[model samples]
Target: MQQSKGRPRTAGAGQESSAERLDGHGREPTEDAGHLRYDDPWYDALASGWGESAGAGEPVPAVVAAARREDESRGAAADVYLEVQRSAAFQEVRRRYRRFVVPACVAFFAWYVGYVVAATTAPELMARPVAGAVNVAMAAGLGQFATTFLLTWAYARHARLRRDRAALELRWDTQELTRGVDGGAS
Candidate 1:
């Protein structure tokens, strides 16, 4: 029952405490739990029931199963995309794209380089008048612009005619496959 003026009463060497010892420190808890009575008070966080799992070894399996299910779903999605890519329809779409793009790129690049080389090496040819004021260089430059527009139109027309429908069908098929993974919801 010894007490200091500012400090609360500390446990005497032989004094018995009535409050339960939660964290094994035999220091008696103060009546006012909101206030800190001692400099080094006992903190039994587990006694407040905050840090507890759902029984012994029950939560581990549920967490592992959830993670494994997610991994399986992700792997299934990747497999679906890979299967579509390896399919004949997808190969045809890629082939059509390359068939148009490769030759067009080479032809346009060669035409541009030829214009530059001709303008640099044979300026007199470029300077020769096409009609009145417009020279060969001007005509060729205008042709470059015209060909760019024509190529753009042709590319759009070719995609619309050849690849777009098949690509759309592939996309729908892909979505259907993924939906099957989700048990085919409405």
Candidate 2:
């Protein structure tokens, strides 16, 4: 069998190497084979199975039980959240968002692409002076920025006017439902 000079390869060997058997520390094993080589007392005790079996079949403490109950309540609250997510109100909000965003994105992208194509293909037209030093290209480029801000304001206004109240009501309703399920303490 081929062998390396450092530690012997323990691939097919029955025993583990000292490195493999290290108990959370880099130290080699001591004279007592049962004791772990860890420097921390807690780690040594843990490795030796200390205090492990004491609470094996015991009932959970009140604090732990309360925490578990809270976790279960939170899990149930998550189900309430999911129900709200699947509700018509939530779906309507999403629909409104998509309705605005999709068309706006498509129009803006098309306008941008048209601007780029015009700039590249019709350089002479783009170079035509609109005012003093500002040309058609400059005006169109500035228009892109103006359109972006206008679209942003319009979207925000639409959301505020049309969807925000409904969506907010839905959120409040969901929160109330979850709080009720959690015994009115959210």
lDDT of 1 at 175: 94
Per-residue C-alpha lDDT of model 1 across residues 20-95, encoded as one tens digit per residue: 2222223445657653333223332234222223232111111234455656876888899999999999999999
C-alpha lDDT values of all predictions: 0.70, 0.73
Question: Candidate 2 at residue 96, lDDT?
Answer: 95
As a whole number from 0 to 100, the lDDT of residue 78 in candidate 1 is 86
* Residue 12 CA displacement from its true place in model 1, Å: 51
Give the Å shift of residue 163 in candidate 2. 0.5
Q: Any runs in candidate 2 off by more than 4 Å, and if so which?
A: 1-67
Per residue, candidate 2 scores C-alpha lDDT tens digits across 1-186 of 112322334547556466644533322467687765443332322233222222243321223445657778989999999999999999999999899989999999999999999999999999999999999999999999999999999999999988999999998898889889999785
Best by lDDT: 2
Worst 10 residues of 2 by lDDT: 45-54
In the predicted model 1, the residue pairs found to clash are none
